[model samples]
Target: MTLIGENGHAADTLTGSGFDFGEEPNPYGAAGFPLDRRYSHSLYHDADAEPHTGTGSMENLGFGAQFPGHPPFRASESFGIAHPEPFIPEIPQAVPDSQARLSVGSVYRPSLGARGLPDLVPDPNYVQASTYVQRAHLYSLRCAAEEKCLASTAYAAETTDYDVRVLLRFPQRVKNQGTADFLPSQPRHSWQWHSCHQRYHSMAEFSHYDLLDVTSGRRVAEGHKASFCLEDTTCDFGHLKRYACTAHTQGLSPGCYDTYNADIDCQWIDITDVPPGNYILKVQVNPKYLVLESDFTNNVVRCHIHYTGRFVSASNCRISQS
Candidate 1:
């Protein structure tokens, strides 16, 4: 019997030499099946004894006789065709101890002025009599030793225009509390360390600071130049090295709170026209998930602020659940 395929080729053909089809067994095995000796010799020695051609034996095609007392045989059940092994995904490994970890340290409001420079008086044209001037808000944060393995490497030629770029050399694969793997691979152009203020900056949206009206839940002010010094031990406005992570050692030194400098303009939002009331100051580090961290939930700091026309006070600031 010959079977033809759609492409005008012989799909399969049965010849007298291929199989017996007789009810009786051949010299090799019962029911026209080849015995072990013939099967092994044909399988290992004879290249022409292809299984698909039936030269190897019809039993290799899952056709076999059942015993007298046993239940009828099924090729799918015996050959595991219907029931396959369950799929199990490969588990991701954990990140090593020596990696960069960034978190918000403190949240406070500073008097409206630049550090080491005179405060700018509100312009008479911009400030109304009923308005109060607001200065730059500060967030003190640290890059611990376990999470401080950043190195400054030259970016690819395509990104030479980017003045600042750092590589997170030893980033770890971390799974979130939900058991989902977060870090897949290292980023090409990951972070930017600004030298003037000793802070790491990124174009990512999550790297900015947002000031919201606690009562209304409305964002009244926002600062995008979220830079911090890796050397400062305290949140004091001192002149520190601007860009720290040149080699691995010079990176944000472990166990330090590189706080914001008042000298930068984008550090504060002008709330002079905002009505005097209670507000919430929320600061988020690495607002975007660009960099990998051991814990992402600790990146946000929430503080209660009391805003009167004359004075602005912040209290009860703590890390909020991410």
Candidate 2:
């Protein structure tokens, strides 16, 4: 499906959903400094689009390494996160997980359909792919030039394995929290650097997407968009953006959102094989239930999709239980 924005260009096609909106005044924040300060620095560093997947054991360490004890936290420009403590807490033991309510926003960006044909990537190559925001204009031009590449190349109608690409803006929202939003300590966790993304990304996979048959309820296609950088890009309840996923901190304050837009590489499912018809597009945040939440019922969202031989349309989007 070709989605032409009001300006005729694809809707925010080449832009990764990022937070540069400047800090929204946080009334709940510390007096002098607005960026809420609770945790210490992150122990690991991400370099060249790769972050440390190291989950250091928090077994023996200072009180700060355990629950209730917070340490110094800082975000690095070149690196990613810096934490003072040696040990970091686990996901289940995370204080915020108890109160933090995670919600998956409806699909945003034009990728809601099949506008991501060019966003498709073969396996193995996806590991080094970069978000469109980090790529050059030439890449978009290349995709535009190859608009017909699908018909000529691997994605012929006879091809059943080609990925039906779609650029997506899956917004991860922090609707509520115990005392704060979903704040995971940087130390126990790890951040990887994406040189192409030119930023820090959570070492964990945050959200997973799948397309299921409406008739049989069978999964036909799926994709895993990384949880992405922790930031408070937009807010709702409190109307104040708190956590920016910046230095000395990382999280999504209540009413705040963390966006993983369609511009990121490989943000679509393999739909070429999916028979043209109606299906349920399902997206779930915290699919593993790794991060404890107050309400798991609201963690899933589904939409009705109609796919003809060549194009697809989405409707009846609703938030539901997985």
Candidate 3:
């Protein structure tokens, strides 16, 4: 295939021949073809020329084009645009809600372990347990102080911007916690599941999981309200009046949500009660969990919640402790 130039001229016809970026001087116009003016670069091909390589490309035969096979090409290990392979399949961002989220197969071992052991072995340190999408929708709600309920009482509907912060606890060790104490400088490579991920070469397959301020599409505040609810729910964040936990993961515990090991984690977000005006509730996914694809169920999970009302505390609600 030959690359046609912007001048309505065929720069060079392929006779198993190569490309020439130089101007087409005295270019030939076919019988009914329009005359070729000096070829101007189109947006797609404007930036110099991409190096082309095929069975007959100059680079294949030792000539570099401006791009991959650029001409005057010093085979310098210098900089140049990197092209993607011809057919990298597109991974869908969203999968059906009810679809099976896991790869189907037995945990097969390829090689025999110390005398052909075939039975599944559990890691004594496996810590038995375990654990633990979407452009979130935003909503705005208004409030005014009806009466001073008390210090611990719900804030009367006095209108103020409700700020929100989302936190995702991971199953991995948390710092200063009694069990599974994690150090601040702990290397990411230390976790078993994480190590398994490295073994599979599937890290890039996941989406960039991060905490997002869904309304503003920004980072969430560390420990304060950053968004407001749009639905007509009393805006409260207090532990007693505002929140409740899901008995979903291993009965109780805190960590990012996961589909395996049966342990549960928690996500906490603070919502504000603003003075009656349209506002956007931002539920930013904690950045730590945003890109994880290991847990497929979470991939299709909508993170759906009906803003029942405002809660007072930034801390997650507990069911087991209750």
Candidate 4:
């Protein structure tokens, strides 16, 4: 894909994971918005282009090589030129009621543990916990997201927009918060289900971790922890807390943030066979675009690590758009 920058020039070749830059939605919709869930499918490549002699295209009646007085015209060409303004899928400068800005706080408490630690994943639902015990190396860290999306950025220009929707039995009654705007819908999500805790856990794929070898440019380790319980664990800001998972609702309200302590079950990435060297430990939240957030960027947090056979040290931590 070609990348153009704000300066109207080609940007430098970038590397790493791809991010959702709030591009225009596909033209497959015929509804409230292009990305709206209730969109009707349109004829794509199956339809042929309009021929020159078709109804408003040009004169279709029998005509000579040249007209007598003037060229044939149509009412559709009243402007003589067709200029449609480009749609910029920009995040609204003012905050929307239902817009949830997802972000990762930090990937702290990196630790190395042996494979198959006792009681690491004791399932209460009788579901097998093999996914946690199978990892050879464990490099666990914490991942969090906050609803203070509007507060994170001072300038609206830096924020990438999010167009989110969900499949529900009653969509008309459930609008995009206060506005009349409606979003496109997708498959229903229980967020996630964890057998270990025995209840619906975090939003599915809400957070994930990875350890990569910087020198070889190869993935050395993968984190087993992804499903996280979305709740208001803590909030340092002054905004009022409005959401709670205890009420059987799943979401992070403004000024609220949720965290999975680094020592949680299956929270580490396996890095057993990797040789000691420089590596990057990447942690991300909302990896699957499951939530309608204020910003798509700031979902990734990466840190540089130097790992010997016995020890690992993380430094130079930074955040970027996924």
Best by TM-score: 2
| Candidate-wise lDDT, in order | 0.33, 0.43, 0.20, 0.34
Query: What is candidate 3's lDDT per residue for 1-322, written digit by digit as tens?
Result: 0121321122222111232326542111222121111111110112332332332323322346323322222333456645443332211111111221222111111111211111111111121122110111122211111111111122336523442222222222111101111111112343123231122111211111122343564533222111111011121133111211211111111221112121221122222221222222222211122121111111111121223233111122111100
Q: Rank the candidates by TM-score, best first.
A: 2, 4, 1, 3
What C-alpha lDDT, on a 0 to 100 scale, does residue 21 get in candidate 4? 26
Relative to the unseen true structure, what is the Cα RMSD of model 1?
26.0
Q: In candidate 3, where is summed lDDT lowest over 10 consecutive residues?
A: 173-182
Candidate 1 residue-wise lDDT, 1-322, digit = tens: 0111321121111111344537643322212323332112211233333332212322333545222222333347656564433333211111111211212211011112211111101111111112223332111111311122111122224433323321100001111121112221233256565554454543333234456878688887554433332222332243333234332222222222333333233334444345678877665554554443333445555666667756666566655654
Off by over 4 Å in 3: 1-55, 58-266, 272-278, 283-322
**lDDT, candidate 2, 54-141, per-residue tens:** 4432442323443434544667767887756443443211211112222221112221121111110011112112212112222342
Query: Residue pairs in steric clash, candidate 4?
Result: 19-322, 36-184, 37-184, 37-185, 100-293, 191-204, 202-228, 202-229, 206-286
All-Cα superposition RMSD per candidate = 26.0, 20.9, 23.4, 21.9
Residues 260-306, candidate 4: write the lDDT tens digits.
54335445554544567787766655455444332334455666766
TM-score-wise, the better of 2 and 3 is 2
